[model samples]
Target: MVCESNSTQAAARQLGINPKLLDRGQQAQVVAEVGSEELALDPEIRALYAANKWLAQEFDVLKTALVFFGQLTR
Candidate 1:
């Protein structure tokens, strides 16, 4: 299936197969071939991205508070 997880007709078309038939046939192969390592990594990658987003939001809030408190000293 070599698609890295994309099973769309466009993926099949790129491989030179007729698009309509490719969908049903390759689906099973793709699922079977996916490694356990990949399955484990997917969640880890998603968690890292989510954590990064949260840290960025928190830093922005802290920055705004710092500015507001600094102004109070004047």
Candidate 2:
């Protein structure tokens, strides 16, 4: 309701609360949002590293198979 109000002061008055408290709550919300976004990056980086490791192993297997088939054909 405070977000939809035309003014923070008026919203606080209507709700019978302090404007400063409402302002602090808003500030805390912004900080939490920023913190959450930063924390989210770690998982994404871990997932990429895992994918890279899997691809490297797959390439080594395919290389060995190609060598074996090459020797048989010759």
Candidate 3:
């Protein structure tokens, strides 16, 4: 897995949007409205999105497992 220490910058680059534009918490709306258009035009972004989605799902599973096993201390 790639280290995403600068996730916002990476996401902004992949979405072809300015990172500053997302400061107002409008990234979701912007993506929802234009994501398809952008995805169709850029295969790289689509691939990145897919990978990110997979990573997120995997992360969720790991978190759930850790919680179930009581490995994650509060």
Candidate 4:
């Protein structure tokens, strides 16, 4: 996962939340923002972003499935 080290500081300044809480909230906000942007994108650009998001989600799903299967087999 990509980490945004500055988010906590930025969120604290903008939202007046504690740094730790700010970090968590900021991460959620970022995800929401990405989702909103994806939905709002023009059809021409949507395909590119959709493809990228699909690949990343697929990787995450496959990785989690593998881990769960491994645990079940053990």
Candidate 5:
């Protein structure tokens, strides 16, 4: 709601809550709880997670290759 709305206070008001309810501490706690729950996954999601990690590693390698070639050209 905050991302879609022009103002964060307006977003909270539309949700029928105070703007202070969107404080950083509350958001951090919510993220930690959600991340913990999400990581408690079954085998299928675990496979996907492993694949995502591999892809991220491949992307980092590609970025390093780009930098190496860019430096060689200069």
Candidate 6:
């Protein structure tokens, strides 16, 4: 579980798989091939990662709201 922002890429590289394919959710095979090795990031890194994920979800919600309002105006 290499938990860097580029974890998928790193895992793909470590397992000699293509990063592009891995990014498309080819993780199960990668995990099967490499087994699970946990990442050892600091608390700050973990917190930042969690914050980024949350922000992404919030952005999606905002986009949906904009689309909804746009449809209502039309």
Candidate 5 lDDT score relative to the true structure = 0.62
Q: Rank the candidates by lDDT, best first.
A: 2, 3, 4, 5, 6, 1
Can you give the TM-score per candidate against the true fold?
Answer: 0.40, 0.40, 0.48, 0.35, 0.43, 0.42
Candidate 4, superposed: residue stretches over 4 Å from native: 1-42, 71-74
CA RMSD of all predictions: 10.8, 16.7, 12.8, 10.9, 11.2, 11.3
Candidate 2 overall lDDT versus native: 0.66
Off by over 4 Å in 2: 1-41, 71-74
For model 5, the stretches where C-alpha displacement exceeds 4 angstroms are 1-41, 71-74
lDDT of 6 at 1: 44
- For residues 1-74, could you state the per-residue lDDT of candidate 5 as single tens digits? 22333486787788887777755444555446446535533446556666887999999888889888895342
lDDT of 3 by residue, 1-74 (tens): 12233887788798898777654344354356445555534657756776887999999999999989999965
lDDT value for candidate 6? 0.62
Which candidate leads the pack in TM-score?
Answer: 3
Clashing pairs in 3: none
lDDT of 4 by residue, 41-72 (tens): 44555566568889999998888898888953
Q: For model 1, give the 10-residue run with minimal summed lDDT.
A: 28-37
Error of 5 at 60 (Å): 0.2
Task: Return whichever of 2 and 6 wins on lDDT.
Answer: 2
Q: lDDT of each structure?
A: 0.61, 0.66, 0.66, 0.65, 0.62, 0.62
* Model 1 lDDT per residue over 7-33, tens place: 566686688887656754644443444
lDDT of 3: 0.66
Error of 3 at 13 (Å): 37
What is the Cα-based lDDT of residue 56 in candidate 5? 95
What C-alpha lDDT, on a 0 to 100 scale, does residue 22 get in candidate 3? 55
